[model samples]
Target: MISGVVVKHFLYCPAIVRITELGFEERVTDSMMEGEEVDKETVGNFLFGVLKAKELIRKPVYKYKDLVGSPDFVLGFSYYYSPLDVKYTNQVHMDHKAQVLFYAFIMEKLGFNVKQAILYYIPVKKLVKINYTNYEREYVERILRNIVKAKKGFLKVRQPVRKCANCGYFQFCKPKRVGNFYEREF
Candidate 1:
């Protein structure tokens, strides 16, 4: 099964997905640990005090076919549900959007009405809403297809030095430092 996490990582850098598939363990950095801690501490404030969601589910695992996701929180409304994810960084990225959308996709498949997905940027106290549109759905599906291809050994592993510096699989990828940047040692 393709996990939502794998999808997020694949979107960031396909090499992360491929390295893990090859049985390499990721080295968790301090920032990653800090992110988890921040997620645990700030989720309550966001769910109850800010959004005022009717119901809040914490870390409920949802599975549909080959996709699985355990979002930080799932807010239940009168008519629909919203998957809320807490991000440590203030800036938003495509991978972050993909993670939230992946959760919404799984929720919809499991028969929950998901109208939107939410991202809580912890540092800046920002809440970004992503509407569950057909375009986003198709985008998630495309990401899933790419994940399948990556698992089947069809991935081009290239990433910028700045991103690789904090990646867990940095050691395994072993990008050679060239001048002022890093390049894969093909």
Candidate 2:
């Protein structure tokens, strides 16, 4: 099964998916540790009070066929459930949206009415709501197909130079340094 976290990482860099499939464990970075700390500190008091949700399930693992997702929180309301994810970053990115959309897709497949997804930015205390529509559904499906291809060793890395410096798998990737710039060597 493809995990939602892996889905998010695939969007960040397809090479990560292939590397993971090769059994190279990712080195946990300080930023990831900080994000976990932030989630632990802020999730309970801030999320519940702000969302005013009737029911809140923290880190509920949901599975549907070949996909599995454990979103930070699942909020239950009168008619539908919304997946909530907490990020330590101030800005929202496409990868983050993809992760939330993956969760929403899995929830829907399990017969839950999921109308929207929520992202909580810890640094800026920002909450962004994304409507789950056909566009998002198709987008997630396309990403899943790409992820499957990547797992089968058909991935081509096209990651940004800036991202490589901060990635945990940088050493394993072994990008060549050329005249003060790093170029990925396939």
Candidate 3:
């Protein structure tokens, strides 16, 4: 049985429902053949944050799945009934991160009171916490909207210029860069 917060997160987060599933493997696979590496410390911080959250008893599912695009990991906090994500980076850069921002968007749309988020910088060995406020929400919404609009405009959907680079997904998106975007799966 799930708690109220967990259910609220799931119910309101349609994007999570749409793509967080393993069935999105085709897209995930495509992502693997593109992109480059980020810092190791950055990666460690992300892994640590996820470890802080409660692990899924099931096959260690990601906290969010890309209903429209590839995000890194998406794990939820059943205790607080909150949405949590792990981002690994050496420095604090937000420009190349979309999936993490998108998670905040989905959390708000789904009705979860996302106060702040945790960012782990491995080299720095620091925890950067920020909330999912109205401003952040609006920003994420704008990005999502742009993506959806672009998809409809094209005869076939192509990936945006960014992806889960610092994610556990690095090995997945390397061989080549597809029509701009591809999914990465192990």
Candidate 4:
């Protein structure tokens, strides 16, 4: 099964493909972990509107064949559930949208109505609502299928691209120092 994080990497940067293939996932760093805690706290602080406790659903793992995700904050579950994902980046990336939408898709597969997915950007204090649509479901499925193919070695490793410079696996996958490059050749 593919996790939301894997989907994010596939969408944002394909250079990490080798890392994922090795089953060497990076540990969520301290700052990222703390951000999640803060996000939970922020949700707790709000007591009005859809952010209210009554609208929020907790402790549920949504799944579909080969797709699984446990959304941190789900508001209402039944005919429909609003999936809310809190992120630390002030800018909302496409992967973030895909992640939540994937969850919404799973919720729908499990026999619930999915209206939309919400992303709360902690730094900018912005809440972006991504309404679930047919286009998004199709898009996510395409990406998921490609990810599965990549995992099974059916797809060749994509050549490193510009995004590799900023990736954590940069050094391991394509180190610049001549000595490092020679060392990795063996």
Candidate 1 displacement at residue 120 in angstroms: 0.6
> What tens-digit string does per-residue lDDT give for candidate 3 at 49-142?
6567654221122333343322233335654323333334576655423344554555555555556554454456665556667787677656
The true-structure Cα RMSD of candidate 4 reads 4.5
lDDT of 3 at 20: 29
Model 2, 90-152: lDDT tens per residue? 899999999999999999999999999998888788889999989989989999998898888
TM-score of each: 0.86, 0.88, 0.42, 0.80
TM-score of 1: 0.86
For each of the candidates, the C-alpha root-mean-square deviation to the true structure, in angstroms, is 2.7, 2.7, 11.2, 4.5
- What are the lDDT scores of the predictions, listed in order? 0.83, 0.84, 0.41, 0.69
- Given candidate 2, what's the lDDT at residue 34? 76
The top-ranked prediction according to lDDT is: 2
The clash count of every prediction, one per candidate, is: 0, 0, 32, 2
lDDT comparing candidate 1 with the true structure:
0.83
Q: On a 0 to 100 scale, what is the lDDT of residue 147 in model 2?
A: 89
What ranges in model 4 sit over 4 Å off?
A: 29-35, 44-53, 77-79, 154-162, 175-186
**Off by more than 4 A, model 3:** 1-82, 95-97, 152-186
Q: For candidate 4, lDDT tens digit of each residue in 46-112?
A: 6225454346665368777878887667876345677777777779899898888888888888887
lDDT of 2: 0.84
Candidate 1 ranges beyond 4 A from true positions: 29-41, 176-186
Better of 1 and 4 by lDDT: 1
Best by TM-score: 2
